[model samples]
Target chain A: MKILVSIKRVVDYQIRPRPAQDGLDVELTNVKMSINPFDENAVEGAVRLKEAGVASEVVVVAVGTAANQDVLRHALAMGADRAILIETPAVVQPLTAAKYLQAIVQREAPDLVLTGKQAIDDDAAETAQMLAGLLNWPQAMFASSIQLADGRATVVREIDGGQETLSLQLPAVISVDLRLNEPRFIKLPALMMAKKKPIETLPAADFSVSAPVLTVLQIAEPPARKPGKILNNVAELVAALRAEKVLP
Target chain B: MSVLVIAELDSHGIKAATRSAICAASQLGEDVHLLVTGNDVAGIALEATKIAGVSKVLHADALAYAHGLAENLAPLLVQLAVNYSALVAAATSFGKNVLPRAAALLDVAMVSEVIQIINATTFVRPMYAGNINATVVAPAGLRILTIRPTVFEAVAATGGAAALETLTATAESGQTTWLSRDLVQLDRPELATARVVISGGRSLGSAEGFKSTLTPLADVLGAAIGATRAAVDAGMAPNDSQVGQTGTVVAPELYMAFGVSGAAQHVGGIKDSKVIVAVNIDADAPIFQVADYGLVADLFTVIPELEAALKAE
Candidate 1:
């Protein structure tokens, strides 16, 4: 089985991003960036499948500007066989990203596609299912555990209330969730070696880019909550909660 | 223009989040239609018809949709999308799974996790894990959206008497097959819809500590149990019990956190809770910043005392 995993570069999870001065988007000037946490899990899962001899090749893809190559390299350092960066400076929406990925899937002809359940940046969580839809393939979203065998993938998905298992034929997309697996740390040697690995760059213009269906009108900070008070002890806490009528 | 809202269903009937979806759809326009698809969802369809502001209910009953697989449900949604100006659903797991696929098939962009419906084409949603709110405007065509149930108020359940329409089951795509499910049987309310939620973090130590320390308080208050990502990662809580950006975003009346450090990811999920109470040994835990009330103490001792105090009442 050949697995293709998709990743994105986003503001580090540790950073509590504030809106930009124009109130149009988050401040991304000189902030620490990293691979989306869920995508890291996806990469780690795909790598593990290859390490287990179940997957023959693992290819990683990202859709963004050249800066996204950093995330693709990180995936390479984690044991992806090759990397593809679809270069575009435009704000790639989910549908656009899905279209770009569909082109990649058609070219690579991988048996499975792996992606993060949602990106930490947009939190859209749409690309994988959209890709599945466009390709008329099946999708398993929020997969906590995935097992591949006999041209089928059994995925344990995280639903609202509990977990549901789904078995999909090959050429399916699986969006990985947290608790899937801990991403392996990149060693100094692997990082050094990954720096030399060639990444294939494809211009977004090469493929027909559709007009954006949705445009961001504005972005602003949500109203902040009022500063809360600290009680002296648990008794005071209970009294305050009761006074607030939150506790029956 | 009319809006079509997909109903989120459980084993019983229409889920509470679907009611909130209806409320969001009603904001879009007057003609708010609902689609309920499942194996045995006649009762669920009937329940959907009673939701206030809904004008019609489209029920699709088939074994293919029994598990609500996106492969089977998305196509039916595409077939039904032509009549409405927009498609809407609560951003639950089901909605999150099905809507984008349908949107892709329709060749339109989807605005997900919407918190506000500014107009028929514009919406307000959170990005970067709820730190930044972005207002998005879609082109003048069919729009797809998934609204955050926590942000929208659920419409009343017993008001309108909408007409019911049955839809023929879409053919099985044969690309995916339903397997087994392992759902945690909860004695208390589900976390997202619960009136009160009691969450713990890594300091809970082990799965035993979560059960022994938190269950009593949850039982006393009739609250659902929640956990921080650290606690869930530590195996102290199930994956579904995790309350965070990646886990579950909850907006309960009262949210109590024991030993939670409140990382940005976790805080994003709970920021919508009406009253947040945090108890932790560390005085400077980030959770205290967003909490409505804070107490600096060890949770192991405080949980039992708080439970006793509530039980005494």
Candidate 2:
């Protein structure tokens, strides 16, 4: 089975991003960048599938500028067999990203597609479901566990109340949550090997890229909490909580 | 312009988050219609009709919708999208799962986890795990949105007399099938909507430690229990109990943390709480920055003392 996985380059999850000076968008200039945390899980899942013999090949894809090759290289070091970059300088919204992925899915004809549940940058969590809709493929979102066999994939999904298990036909889309697996650490040997590998590049103009539908009006910091007081004892804390009507 | 609010359900009736979504829908436009779809969910639709701002409730009951699988449910939304100006739902797992597919099928843009409705076209939503809030203007066509439930007050549940409309057409994408469900049955209130929450960190070494340390305090306060991702990762708590950027984002009336270092990811989820109190041995723990009250002490000793004090009172 050929598995295709999508990864995104975003501001590192550890770094707190601030709004730009002009307040039009988040400040991305000179900030630390890394693979989105969940997408790393996606790449890890795909690599594990190949190692387990369920997948014959794993191809990792990203949609960004030349800089996205960094994340592609990171995926390669994790054992993805090939990399493809859909080069675009513009900020690709979820639907437009899905359209690009749809074009790739048609070209690759992979049996399964994997993606991070959501990107930390936008926190939109829309691409995989949108891709599934555009491709007319079944999707299992927020998958915590997955088993592939007999042209069907059984997935355990994390839900609000509990876990729900579903079986989807092969050639489906699966967006993974955090609990799926801890991504393997990239070692020096694999990193060195990945650096030498060539990445296939395709211009975003080649695909049926649609016009942007959403416009950013402004970006600002969320409301801040009031400064708190440090209590010296449990009794003082309890008394203060009661007076504030925070304790019953 | 009419707005369609998708109602989420459990075994009992309409979920609380769906009520909040209805409240958000009412803010967007005057005509608010709710769609309740599931197997034998007519009762839920009837419950929806009683919500103050809802003008109509659409009920679609069928076995194919029992699980509310996105494959089948998205097509149903696609069928209904033409008549509505916007489709709205709570940004819970169910809404996050179903609405995006419907939006894509209709080839429209969606703004998820909306915290404020700036106007009919503009919205405010958090990005980078609540660090930054972005105000976005959606396309002029059909708008798709999911409201962050905790930010909006629920509409009154017993005021309106909305007409119940039964929908017969069913859309089933046969590519996916539901198999089973494993839900953690909690005896206490749900973490998302509880008035108070008591959460712990990895300092509780084991699952046994996690339960013993927090359960009594939770019982005394009548609050729900939650955990940091570190605790869940360490197996001290169940995955469902995780409260962080990657886990359940809660906005309870009061949130209490014990031995939590207050990482950004963890704070991202709890920043919306009305009152936050943290207890930790480390005085400089980051959780104190966002907390309304901070105490430097051993959580093990603090837990017992606090529980006993509340019990005595």
Candidate 3:
């Protein structure tokens, strides 16, 4: 069985992204970038599945510019056998992303696909579900636990107020949650070995998908939080809250 | 243009988040209908009708919806979506899972996790992990929205008597079948809806320390407990207890972070919290920048004394 994992390059969560000077996009020039935290989890999930003998090969896919190859290499170092990058410098929305993913899914025909619940950058949390819809495959989101048996995968999803477990047939899409697995650091040797892995780059324009549906009117910083006063003691903290009527 | 609000429910009735979604839907269009799907959601359907501004409730009673699986929900919503100009739900987990699938099938763009409704075809949503606020405008097609309920007050559940309608459309739950559930049922309020939250960080030292130190303060304040990603990564706290960019996003009336030197990711989650209180031994923790109240003290000693002081009150 082949497992396809999708990864994205996002600003490191530790580094705050500043809005670009145009006020229509986030400044990405020279920003610290890393594999999206959840996508890192996706790579780990796929690697573990391959390790447990559930998967014969793991292919990591990214749907962005050539720069995305950087993230795909990280996925390779994490144990994916091969990588594919859809070289599109254009802004890729979820729908556009799903189309590119669908193209890759058709080509790979993997038994299962793993991706982050949401890309921390867009926070759209929509690509995997859209891909599932396009492929007409079963989808499980926010999966905390996944077990494979008898050509089916059972996933425990972190839902509102609780977790729900379900078993779905093969060729399904599952989005990884935060607690799925802790990704291991890539050893220097593994990073060097990843240089030999095959990485196929496809032009994003090759896929005939619908154009982006949403138009960006403006991008600005979210309202700034007000600066606060430091309380003298615990009593002062309680008293200040009481004075503000936030506490009774 | 009519709107359909997807209703999420518990054993008691419709959830507060769904109620807030209904309110957001009411603002989007005039005829707002609610669809309640579950194995035995007749009572919940009735509850949905009484929610203010709901003109009607569509009940899809079946075993398939017992767990809110997207496999069943997406097709079901697509079938009923023809009459509605827009589809909406809270940006909660259920909405995040189901709506995109339906939107994809319909070949429409989904306006995700919006904080404000600009118009029928426009909205403002946070992007870049709450760092940038972007105003998005979509075409005149069916607008799919997942609203953050905390940004909008939930509509009252009483003072309405809308009619309830049952749908005869069949739905396939796909190959996915409900197996089991692991729920965090606590005596205290859920962190998502909690009015007050007391969170700890890596300085809590260990899981045992996280529990023992925070439980008393949580109990005394009648607040839900939370943790920083640092603590979660350290195995000092559970994943669900984590509040950060990767974990659950929360905005409560009062938020108190103990020993939490806030990282941008953790602070990203709690930015919407009305009043933030930061307590740390370090005089210049990053958390103090966003804190409405900063306290420099040893949490180990101060928390216990604070609990006693509140108890004395």
Candidate 4:
């Protein structure tokens, strides 16, 4: 089976995010960038499938600027057999990204495609399922675990309450959940080998996808949290809750 | 203009969050129709019809829709999209999974986890894990959106005239088939859906500590158990049990934090709660900022006493 893993370079989750001075976008001047944490899980899942001999080859695809090559390299170091970069200067919306990816899927024809449940930056969490719909393929979103046997893929999805297991035919799309696996680190030797690997770069315009339908009007900071009142004791707190009619 | 709201149902009728989404939908327009897609969901459809603003209930009951897979539901929704001016659903796992696909197929913009509908054209949604709120405008047409149910109150069913519509579409599209479902049966209330929640942080120490100290208190109060990212990362609770920016966002009537030093990421999850109470050893924990009531005491000592008090109540 050929596996395709989609990755994105996003603002680091640890740092506080601020809107750009233009007030239309996020300030990315000096912000630390890394593979989206959820995407790392997707790559790790693909790597595991390859290691288990379930996949014949694993390809990592990223859609962004030249800076995203570093992210593709990281995926290569982690165990992807090849890398493809769909270069675009501006950040693409989830729908546009899904369209671009669907075009790539048509060309690559991978039996399985894995992507993060959502990118940390946009938090849209729509790409994988949208791509599946665009391709007219079956999809299992937020998959915590996956197993392949007898030409079918069994996916364990993380739902609101617990888990639900589903089986899909080959050539299905899946989005990885946080509990899928602990992503492996890139060792020095693998990093050096990754530098020697081949990377094919393509432009987003090459794909016949339309512009994004939604437009971001403005970005602003969320409402500030109210200052907390300090109580002397648990009795005081409980009394206050009762007074507020929350504890009745 | 008619607005279409998808009511998500489990084995137990319509979900509370779906009711909240319907309430949000009512805010959008006067003519609101609800679509309940599942097997043997006629009772759920009937219950949904009783909500004050719902004008009709559309049922798409079939074995194929039992799991409500995106591939199956998206097409069904796309077919229905042409009839309505706006489409809305709860921003749950099901909505997040399917709505975007439906939107893409209709070639329309979709706003996810919307906190407020500024109008028919604009919406407010959290970005960067609630650190930023982006007010977006969709290019005018049939607008699709997923409402964060926690942001709105579920409007009570106040007897409304409802018409039932049965939709049938033959499509062999969903590549996935449900094999089995393993629901974690908990005697405790569901954290996200609960009216009251008691959450613990890393200061509680271990999973054993939480199970022994906090769980009993929560059980007594008839509240759901929640955990901060610190506690979840420490493996003190399952990922599903976590409540934070990265985890489930819950808004309850009463929220109690035990030993939780509120990080911005963690606070975002509970900001919508009607009343928040924080208990910590440190008087200056950030949790106090958003908390309506605060207590300065070691949770180890206070929790047991609180449990006893609730038991006495």
Give each model a TM-score. 0.96, 0.97, 0.97, 0.95
Q: Is candidate 3 or candidate 4 better by DockQ?
A: 3
Rank by DockQ, highest first: 2, 1, 3, 4
For candidate 3, what is the DockQ-based docking class? medium
Q: Give candidate 2 misplaced runs (Cα > 4 Å).
A: none
Model 2, residue B42: what's the lDDT? Answer: 74
Global lDDT scores for all candidate models: 0.90, 0.91, 0.88, 0.86
Docking quality band of candidate 1, CAPRI definitions: high
Number of the top DockQ candidate: 2
Which run of 10 residues does model 1 chain B get worst, by summed lDDT?
B7-16
The Cα error of candidate 3 at residue A117, in Å, is 0.8
Lowest lDDT 10-residue stretch of candidate 4 chain B: B167-176
lDDT of 2: 0.91
Per-residue lDDT of model 3, residues B58-149, tens digit only: 99988778878788888888888888899999998888989999999988889988998888888999877677788999888688899999
Candidate number of the best lDDT: 2
Q: Give fnat for candidates 1, 2 and onward, in order.
A: 0.91, 0.85, 0.82, 0.79
**Per-residue lDDT of B146 in model 2:** 96
> Deviation in angstroms for A140 in model 3?
0.9
TM-score for chain B considered on its own, for each of the candidates:
0.94, 0.96, 0.96, 0.93
Report the C-alpha lDDT of model 2 over B1-313, residue by residue, as the tens digit.
6999998888878888888999899888669999999998777788778888888999999888898899989988998889999999999999999999999889899999999998999999988888889999999989999999999998888899999999985767789999998877889988888899999999988899999989989999999999998899899998889887888899988999999999888898999998999999998899999999999999999999988888889
Q: State the DockQ of every prediction.
A: 0.80, 0.81, 0.78, 0.69
Clashing pairs in 2: none
Ranking by lDDT: 2, 1, 3, 4
Which tens-of-lDDT digit does each residue in A181-201 have in candidate 3? 889999999999999999999
